[model samples]
Target: MPAMTEPKLISGNSNRPLAQQIARRMSLHRGMSVSLVDARVERFNDQEVFVEVYENVRGEDMFIVQSTSNPANDNLMELLIIADALKRSSASRITAVIPYFGYARQDRRTKARTPISAKLVANMITQAGIDRVLTLDLHATQIQGFFDMPVDNLYAAPVFALDVQHHFKGRLQDVTVVSPDVGGVARARELAKRIGCALAIVDKRREKPGEVAEMTVIGEVTGKTCIIVDDICDTAGTLCKAASVLMDAGATEVHSYITHGVLSAPAVERITKSVMKSLVITDSIQPTEAVKAAPNIRVVPTAPMFAQAILNTWSGTSVSSLFDVDTLTPIYEGLYHRG
Candidate 1:
């Protein structure tokens, strides 16, 4: 087979630190050189987004690193405009590397007269001329079908498992993975299986988005190190409540491993004052100053995993193995080398 075109990384304003980290890891690849594209994504006086590519990317494979997080509309627009700009510049292929896809929680309608914003966002990306998508842990896995192009949805379980192993080095048998709600049992089960620990669920009566009326521990958590696993932690009302409930149920310690820390509003304060031992989150969303200053919060790097996935997609290698628990150790150990 002929050699594929060199891949170029580009970044929007959403999460430049993470983009730089991914680019740095890619550039460290043994026999290949990958670099970020020199591009300017600016705004007009009326707050309209504008993009200008300085490099001559006539036939390059482009990957735009943008997380549609806090300013969801602005970051999303920047991605779409960047994709359109790259398409107009004659790039061979464009892949959107969205670490945190916004509107994902709205994958379906829960009430009367509401739009499925997740599907709408997917359609917008398809219409914006992106050829493919590379994202991590969609709120609803079914959202992948909303796009017309190929979508690579990566999981963070392997990364979390490694952290869990390191955090509770001697007490693996005393750990229990707890899902904040029944809906997240599968996620918690996968993590527990990876760590060879027991599984538990918190049956919560959710009153609203961030509010939980009551919670009951469904399994034995007494004297165990409880680790709450969930995707998005917005206002954190539910997480805080769940942690207290677990502790009340005789859990020795409570820690959380949430993927996207959408720590909005009083989330930081709530988590800081809660009984949870610590909250470990990924850098899927750029951590705010408050999130950084919080005493009990820790952010993990996803750049190594993301860089590998990007390289695999460009080289047409299997990406599913990246999430395999056994393969992740080597994948993280040798990220700068070709697989």
Candidate 2:
């Protein structure tokens, strides 16, 4: 058994496989050997939620792994209920490890009479007694401000950069990183810098919500293999559209490295028929059956990154520095070496 402040990992019903993988990573190489503790979260006949922490969590620091993905409302309730249970059980500290933050896209009022649900969700978690938050590749960085507590917004750029480098190993110079929209230029640029590639942008305009978007290439992409980058790939409508424009602009091939794969509705079918060579997404959301059936879609695990973040946070080290190539490369190598 680990000590009281050893940072126990507890998971809700969301993305249990990811939680298990993270547990395995943390337990590697005779380190702390911390594993997940059981926290049974279930519902009643009338759909009322219930949570029970079997382990003695008194004074123990706990991190709850829950991605509010599809069926978002149910998962959100589960997270809140579990946190409430842990708090009442005398847990010293609780960090909500949300890999895919739901309602994050609604950080601001896009239209009149609409709710700022992101802030609402943040407030809900804070009121539930979570001391901190750990989430990956939020749809908006400003969502951190919504949380009054300490929020660590981890990036998938480092992971995607390493994978991109490996994929385009010898032909690195031929790769051009692209942003699917002007909004994502920063995220795309970060990955581009990490990969030592040039950057491009797709200028797009959206007139209304839930409508197909049109974009045009605004940078040199001729005869290059383009990798469009963004934080979320929901529905993949704009993504596939951008890929088509890139190919029309004479890009040899097009791929995307999106952090969240919210393949809602016809996303899988759209991507399957898109001009992109491949659509690489993180397992931030558990891949659905349709997502798995797509031949051109690749799913990458984010568990190792989360594990490192958890360990560093518990040890009072800098979790933000893990995105630096100088820092994360050796760490990832260590993971493979251990394997």
Candidate 3:
């Protein structure tokens, strides 16, 4: 495969610091040489969105860094407009590097007349002329199938694994990896394998939106340090409930490692009052004010991983090996010891 020329890194209003960190790792500046047209997004009297890009991007390989998180619709619109601008300016190719894809949990219709909002979001991006996408930890892996163009679903396990190691030192045997629900067992199993620990699952049922009732435990969590792992934590209901159940099951301590801390309504409050020792999350979705102020919340930087992935893709190298399980073991051990 022939290496493509280096792509210009563009940024939307979401997580600018993360985008800058990735750019620094790649030894480039954001929007280098090319004119970055800032889209001054506004609302009409009735509250509809309007966008216009102010600069040129002709003949460049474009990578727009945006996270469809929090103010979801606004951020999504920003990404669409940026892509449209690049397409209109004759950019050679456009890639939407959405570290956090919102509305992913709506991938399936649970009722008779519900819409698959995840698919709708995919359609919107596709229609906006994005040639490819790079995102991490979709709520459901099948969501990738919804996209017609090339889509890279990066894993946050490696990132979380490193943090766990650093915080636990060499006592991997005492640690138990946990899945907050049955659907997350595979994810938890993978983390347990990488970290060389036993695995457990929390049997939980969502009584209703934003409410979770923990029913049982699938594996042994007794007298062991438990780390609840999940792709996203929106309301914190499920996570807190699972943590409580693990404690009742005789787990020594409870901690959580979530990919995207959507940390919406009462989430921080719930986490603050839960049995969790700490809530470790990635910088995929910028945390809200409450999340930032929470003492038990710690953020693990993902810039290096994303930077390397972007560079590898641009240089026409295989990224499959980047997901090596062994490489992450030591990193997690180190993080465990530090904590």
Give per-residue lDDT, candidate 3, residue 95: 87
- Go through the candidates in order and give the clash count of each: 0, 0, 21
Q: After superposition, how far is residue 303 of candidate 3 from its true place, in Å?
A: 1.1
The all-Cα superposition gives candidate 3 an RMSD in Å to the true structure of 3.3
Best by TM-score: 1
Residue-level error in angstroms, candidate 1, position 143: 0.3
Off by over 4 Å in 3: 1-4, 28-55, 325-339
TM-score of predicted structure 3: 0.90
Q: Which residue pairs come into collision in candidate 1?
A: none
Q: Please provide, for model 3 over 1-339, each residue's C-alpha lDDT reduced to its tens digit, 9 standing for 90 to 100.
A: 664455677888888878877777666423354333354555678766565555566776778889999889889988898788779889888989999999998999999999999999999999999998988888899999999998888899877777777778777789999998889999999989888999887887767877665479989888899999999988888888888889999999999999998898889999998899999999998877788899899888777667766766676676555687464343234334433
Candidate 2 runs further than 4 Å off: 1-4, 29-32, 334-339
Better of 1 and 3 by TM-score: 1
Q: Write down the worst ten-residue block by lDDT for model 2.
A: 330-339
User: Candidate 2: which pairs clash?
Assistant: none
TM-score of each: 0.96, 0.95, 0.90
Q: lDDT by residue for model 1 over 1-339, one digit each (tens)?
A: 534677789999999999999988887763566667888999999999999999988888899999999899999999999999999999999999999999999999999999999999999999999999999989999999998889999998889998888778888999999999999999999999998999999999977765677889999999999999999999998999999999999999999999999998999999999999899999999999999999999998899889989988888888898888666676567422222
TM-score of 1: 0.96
Alpha carbon deviation, residue 160, candidate 3 (Å):
1.1
Local distance difference test scores for all models: 0.91, 0.88, 0.82
Candidate 2 residue-wise lDDT, 39-117, digit = tens:
6888899998899889998898889999998889999999999899899999988999999999998889977999999
